[model samples]
Target chain A: MYRTLVGIGLICALVIVTVFEVTFPIIKVNKQRALENAIYQVLANTKSFSAYHLVGNNNLQKVTDNDTSDIYACYDANHSLIGFAIAAQGMGYQDTIALLYGYSIRSESIQGLVVLQSRETPGLGSKIESRAFLDNFNNIEIGLDAIDNERQQPLELIKNNSKTHTRQIDAITGATISSRAVVVILNRSLSFWLPIVAKQQEPIT
Target chain B: MSTKPGEIIVTGPKDTDEFIKGVWAQNPVFVQVLGMCPTLAVTNTASNALVMGLATAFVLLMSNVLVSSLRHAVPKQVRIASYVAIIATFVTAVDYIIQAVSLEVHKSLGAYVSLIVVNCLILGRAEAFASKNNLKRSIYDALGMGVGFTLALLCLGVVRELLGNGTFFNLSVLPGNFQPWVIMLLPGGAFFVLALWMLLINRLKQGGPRD
Candidate 1:
């Protein structure tokens, strides 16, 4: 009995170790490439980007330490700042929706949105990744307050085709919860980062 | 190996019988009703269903081959544990492979891919078929079962995608005015479709209509 158990254990260990060694590098490269692509995708018109951490009280701290909340400063072809891409997460219909979106400091609006990860229900909630839904973020104004404390107009999801307000997003039909979740996530993320972004100058990279 | 009383021993594989049984008589989803979780969860779209079915089939085939090859060496007492470990190793390998292929599909499949480790279909095959069979027969059994599973999933997926989204494989198949049955895209719809498939299969098995 003892010998049999040990043999099984050894076999399992060998298989696992062999597979891990073979696949780990490919998985790593794939993930890194995806991350880079997502960063560039969200912040369009970007020539390059520099990573920075958001430290205490939403300060733009240098990227000396590895943190999940690190923001990317996007630069244009002339090496001038275009915007910043920040990662955000919030509750969706079935799971937490994690995404990265670009914010244009000059226009005080979101440049674009890209879903990094979402477990939203297929055919409905998953429409959050649809071009129609994501296009709603393009140049949508997120006005900063006098004290830069709050957004002048909070993001809202209206029924599809009835969107009138600059802050309103046309929600996907039958996916109200998921559409609302995206709006809520955008609002929450903007509330935290917009103020800091508005106050800070382009960091020396 | 001595057969105990009432322990109906599986005979040496007659290639075609092993293969065809899985496709029709012993269809995992429609007939034997195994692996319901993935069958219902990922069948909302044909593409998602196809990818998921293929992934499960890959794991099933690899695990069956490994289990059959190791059957002689593994002792009866620890066989189940050994089988599970073997299945899990394959699942992890496929998981990484899918992640490398497409992050979108990987995310869509999500935890369901990992959950394949616990899928009774793969384990059931390993224990009931592979453990008692030789490698070549086990491979044939795995292939048939895998293909059967994929076909069953495709049926559900095609029906659901066509009715729920008015699209098949993401292309609009139904007329523009045709309103999609939103219910067909939800979890409740999955149960309805599977139940209907089972009912249809049962009726066919019973032959001409009977009160």
Candidate 2:
């Protein structure tokens, strides 16, 4: 009889612990959401946007129709439109890294970028998240060639360094591969978004 | 090595022997091949690897001791469930502590923190060592095993970071003129490093497990 009661008591103790365990994480879950939203606002530069609309499923804009990327679009106060920012993904040393980059049709340049996901070796290729690395895009163009094409060739980093590419940006020293991969993903993704931007820029009566 | 019916006494030097066995001799990842998921996932940085190792160690130590203390009381059919519950509680505690102290590390680790509850090494040690031994021995064994796992993660983190970025812990370790291997920062690079590391460890041990 005592053994059965002790077993019941132990089960109840476990049940209480489980209940407590399950409840607090739910509260923490909400706090986490708030923290995440605050971080997103900081990176999204929502203040610069006069008009911000959450688009697509859960307000995420699918960057590639193929669903390879997604981005949050921010418009300036004038509504002339600031830029098309999208989150892009590529393989890093140990894991996939997702990044948010803003391309401006008006400036014909990249405004900024933020690392959204990365499994790169810490203290190394993960520098993609560092402000120094990301700041490289501040004034760089999307198209690579000096010769203008009806379709702009998005900017990318080349290992050998070429002078002819208008869109070329300096790759991070010792992190050439990561730098180049980030550029390629940004360029490939911009190709898809540009047409949309061009279409959106079109006057709709 | 037989103890009570169905219980096997692990023959070793005993006492300190049980404690030191997991560090290099019976390493959970390289030597034992246990707990491969987190071993592969969170080793992108030395800091991250250290945090994960510490968190796992905390859980392993507590769970091993608790399970050992209650070994005889647990019914055979429900032993696994009981062990898991104990582990999950410790994991939740570690998660909260990490979040409170360093949100940066917490963010970097993400889901893998919670996933530690399921890591095989903790439960494996609990069942294999704790179930048959007294609490003191179990604690020692857990600590030793935890150190081994931590060392392995540190090795992976250092190799990947140095090759990929020419730096260690964000400090420039290589010359400015050196070109980093971009592949070292990619998933393919991780797999390559892991394979090479295992092979190196294997060769170092003469194609056999190290003691």
Candidate 3:
């Protein structure tokens, strides 16, 4: 009995490993293409982009795509830098919501946002991906006004489109929690990433 | 399986009956109502349903072939474990293949592709049919069942996408002025569509006058 079980296990493992090896390269290519497309979408008019990875918590280094998470510096057709595309994720209504957004240091605001991976409630909480809600992130202020290594004012969530400030994200009518969830995700992501990004401080001018 | 005249009149372990029964007589979705998790969750679009169906079928076919080939070697006590492991291997393969083929379809299917390992239909076949049958018979059975499962998902996908979104396979079929049925796109809509399909299949079965 033991021998037979071991035999089956061996065969199964062999087949799986073989399949994984055969398809690994192709899967990697597909994923890389998808990320590039998302970066382009969020950054707008980005004809190309260069990949970078942060060493430890501070030093951002340019690197080729591998297992390491990449932060993209988007460029236009003339190879001039447009902005940066950063990836972030946190808990949403249903599952982890992985997001990508473009940040313009010049404007001190986010250029655009895309829900890279979302399992929020369809038709309800899922509205975070809707154009009406995502438009909130387009050029919205994050105002890098740091005081003693902390944001002077963290991003805020408001309702009824009565936002008193630029960085304040408005909660949509139907997807209030989901909208807040995105903001919460963004806030957490920004608190960690923005400081690192601000230190690099390379203006595209 | 059925005493009827040309009405699913097919039964035998080695012949085409192994294939035919799964399509008409023993459909995993309509007749057995197995794998409701994906059947309900991802069938929101016809294209999603088609891709899912193909993935499930591939897993089923490969697992069934593996299980049947090893049936005699595996002991009764660990049979279920062996079957599950086999099914899961194929499911992983399908998941990777889908991811490589199209990222959008993979996203739409989400974790349901991984969920195929837990699907009772594949396991049930490994236990009940494949274990006792020969390799040739299992192949027919898997293909038939695969086609049947795909067709069933397509059925629900077509209706749901059409009524709910006023489209089929993302193509606009309904008139421009047609008001979409909002309920057909919700989680609740899956139950409604499934119940309707079950009703239709069973009713048709009973309505066969010459059977």
Candidate 4:
């Protein structure tokens, strides 16, 4: 009886392990495809370029594209620099909210901010993904302090005290921690990438 | 081994006490400390807690019945691993169903749906009662436990949502400009609410073994 039981147990274990191993690769492939599709959607209007090659292994890259403000640098069919995308991240209450900002090298400012992922509370912290909130970044010129490459004035949201067309965003009411987290992450990411972007750009008048 | 369903001896509390024990008494979260992940992870809002509780209850019911029926054949040494695999299969089934039906809710709940495999409530039921009792008794125990868990999650969800967002299940009850306490939605909020609940329940119980 003992020997029979052990044999059955081994068989069951082997079957389970084999099933998982067989399905693991397929699962990974599906997840990767989904992620790629999401990123492509965020980086809209990619048809203007001939290529969309990933820049580095870090998974965070500065890309240049046209008709976009946050563009860092993009290349034409002949490998010429067109625009750039500045990627930034901020800490939210539950998880880091990654933003893909498209900046135009020609325009020299942020085009728009797209929230990639945030684990914030639904109906509350999730407002960061809403257009009403993200619209705040549209066409805002990247005006960080040139001295030591730090921002002169950090971007923030003043809740219920909206000043229209200012660089500041209106913070989501009652979600100040989450709101500040996004601001801090956005500022920090932009700050980190500003120097790298400056190094890549030619001397602009 | 030959005992029929409902024929096994029940040594614990009789009648409604067994049924009511889980409410806040032998509450799975506060008293027994079972199902910690769901309680902590899903109680961000009232809606998530409700769905999570129902899902867990379904899994608990099925696992209890099956385990009780098969307790004799499950070899003693490998029972733990077998029970896990069984419970995980049911959890995976639930996950796919949820995903197929409501993509939005699935997105909100995220990986917590899969983490149900490790929920201690199902495993505890399997070990404590299912392994000893017949199928009918096991079903009753599982139902009681499920109701208990749902009630506990509901309580937590109601408090957190009302305090954090000034609403229950997204129905705004608080007046405009309530200035919600933001911490009620954070992980810290889950811990504090659970601890306070335990204290309150303890006081109510007068130091008795929670239900």
Strongest candidate by DockQ: 3
- Residue range B139-207, candidate 3, lDDT tens digits: 888888888888888898989989887898989998999876767777789899989988878888788
Collision pairs in model 1: none
- Cα lDDT tens digits for candidate 4, A1-205: 4664565456445654665665555555554443334334443433233222234532323333321323334444445554455556667888878777665555566666677568877668888888888777777776433424553545666888575655687888767777778778777766665565655455321
TM-score, B chain alone, candidates in order: 0.90, 0.86, 0.90, 0.87
Interface RMSD of each candidate, angstroms, one decimal: 2.1, 6.1, 1.6, 5.7
Once superposed on the true structure, which residue ranges of model 2 sit more than 4 Å away at CA? A1-85, A89-96, A103-108, A119-136, A141-159, A163-166, A169-205, B1-45, B88-118, B151-168, B173-211
Against the true structure, candidate 3 reaches a TM-score of: 0.85
Give the C-alpha miss distance for residue A95 in model 1, angstroms: 2.2
Question: How accurate locally, in lDDT, is each candidate?
Answer: 0.81, 0.68, 0.82, 0.68
lDDT of 2 by residue, A1-205 (tens): 3463366357546754765666566546654553344334333444333222335422333332322325444555554555656666777666777776666656656667777677665456767777777766666665322223545556757554453554566676667777877887876767665555555544310
Winner on lDDT (2 vs 3): 3
lDDT of 1 by residue, B1-211 (tens): 0112112323534664677667667889988899999998888889989998898899999889988998888889889988888888888888878887777788777788998898899999999999999998888789878888888888889899999999999899889999878778887899999999888877876886998
DockQ for model 3? Answer: 0.51
Best-performing candidate as measured by TM-score: 1
User: Any runs in candidate 4 off by more than 4 Å, and if so which?
Assistant: A1-52, A55-94, A100-114, A120-133, A139-205, B1-25, B195-211
**Listed models, DockQ each:** 0.47, 0.08, 0.51, 0.09
TM-score of chain A for each candidate? 0.85, 0.61, 0.81, 0.64
Distance from true position, residue B205, model 3, in Å? 1.0
Question: What count of clashes does model 3 give?
Answer: 0
